[model samples]
Target: MALSSQTTALAQIPRVHIFPTAGEAADAVAEHLLATVKRNPKSVLGLATGQTPRHVYAKLVHAFREGKISFCDVETFNLDEYCGLTASHPDSFAAFMQRELFGLADFDPRKTNLINGDVQDVVAEARRYATRLKESGAVDVQLLGLGTNGHIGFNEPGSASDSHVRVVDLADETLSANQPSLIELTSVPERAITIGIADILHAREIVMLATGSAKAGAVRRSLREAPSTDCPASFLGTHQAVHWYLDNAAAAEIG
Candidate 1:
C-alpha cells in the first residue's frame, strides 16, 4: 500500500519506485513488510535470500529488537534452496535466513518453512513443500530478488509461466553467480528447489527488489517488455499488486 508516496507507474505496471540509494529502497521495503505484519500478525510471508534482501532483513531484525514487531504469529516460506546443501550448511538459504533474519528475530521455529535440499527424494520434497504452502491459506506478501538472467526464485528463463514448485536445473549464469568459494567448482549445486511462477503470482502482494548496474537490463525488461518466459521476471507484470523497488543503478536501463 502506499509505503512510499514517491511512486511512479511505468507503462501499465503499478507502484514502481526508484530510490536514490539501495539503503533507502531497502528501508522502504522493510517498513512495508513491517506494516504488513502489524496489520496481520498471522501474515504468511514469502521470503527471499541474496544480497538484494540482506539489508531488508537487517532492518526487520532491528525492528524486532526495538519491540516494533513480533514474529510470534508470523509464518515464513523461503523462495528456493540449493539442492545439495544441508540446512545447516553455512551457504544454504536456510542458514542464510537464520543468520540474517530468523536468528536475529523472534520467529517461531515451527512456523518457519524452508525446503530441505539434502533429502534423497527431491521431487517428493518439492510436492510436500508446495502442499504446505497451499495449506497456509495464502502468502500475504512475496519478496523477490531479480537474477541477472531474468530469473526469479531460481525459476530460469525457459521456465513455464504456469509451473508449480519443482526441482529445476540451475542455469549456468545462476550457478556461476552463486558459486561458493569454499567448495570446489565441480561441487557447486547444479539444481535447486524453487517455488514456481504460479506460486509466486498467488501472493496477494509482490515486492520485487533489484539493485546494481548488473540488474539494469533485467529490471528494464521486466517493466517494459512483453510478458515472456524469455525474461521470467516479465511475467510479474501480469499481477495486479506488484510493487518494484529499484535503486538508480538498477533503473538505469529503463527508458
Candidate 2:
C-alpha cells in the first residue's frame, strides 16, 4: 500500500524528472525502492534489465552492503527474459540479476522469480507466470528500462493490448541493444517471454528509467506520442501512478 500511487490527470502527460547524471538518478531510484522495502517488509517488487538498471542495481548493492537496505523480505519478478537461454547462461536475465544485484545483496533466493527462457512449453509457462503474478496481487512498484524502440519488457511495436504473458518476437533495435549479453548481433536471441502491457498497467506503481543520448528520441516519442501499440512505454501515462526518471542526455528531446 505504501507504493500504491494515487490516480492523477496524467493520462496524456506523465510526471518526468531529469537528473544531471545517471548516477544521481540511480541513487534517487534506489532510495525510493528502499523506502518501499522499509515501509512494507514483505513487498512484491518487479524489476527490469539492460544497461539502464546497471547503475541503479549498483547503488542498491552498495546500500545492502552498508546495511541501508535489505531484500531478505522482498519478492521480485523480472520483466522478461530472452528465449532459448538457460538460467546459467551468461547472457540470461537471471544471470544478470545474480551477478549485478542478488549475488551482492541479501536477497531471498526462494522469493526471486524469473521466466525460464529455456523452457520448451513457452505458452504454458507464460500462462503459469501470469497466474502467479495475479495471485501475488499488484506489484508494489515495477521498475522498467525503456527500449530504444519504445518497448516495455518485450512488448514490441504492434503488440496487442490484451496481450498478457507471452512469447514474442524481438525487434531489430531491441536485439541490437542487448548486444552486451551476446557474443555478436547474430548470437542475440530472436524471441523473449514477457509480461504484457495490461499486467504492467495493473501495477501499483511504475518507475521507468532512461539514460544516454541514444534514448532521447524514444523517450520523447513515448511521452509525446499517443498511447498505442506502436509505442508500448507510452501506455505508462495511462497508469494512476508512474514516475519517469531521465538523465540529461536522455531528456534532451523532452521539451
- Tens digits of per-residue lDDT for model 1, 73-122: 99999999988889988778898899899999889999999999999999
Tens digit per residue, CA lDDT, model 2, 1-255: 122122223322446766778777777788779888889989999999887898889988988888877789999999998888889888888998999998999889988989998888988889888988899899999999888888999999998667788989999888778876563235688988999999888889898888889988889888888888888888887788988877778877876
**Model 2: how far residue 50 lies from native, Å:** 0.8
Using lDDT as the measure, the top candidate is 1
Count of steric clashes across candidates, in order: 0, 0
Candidate 1 residue pairs in backbone clash: none
**CA lDDT scores, all candidates in order:** 0.89, 0.84
Provide the RMSD of all predictions against the true structure, rounded to 1 decimal: 2.2, 4.3
- List ranges where model 1 is wrong by over 4 Å: 1-13, 180-187
Inter-residue clash pairs, candidate 2:
none
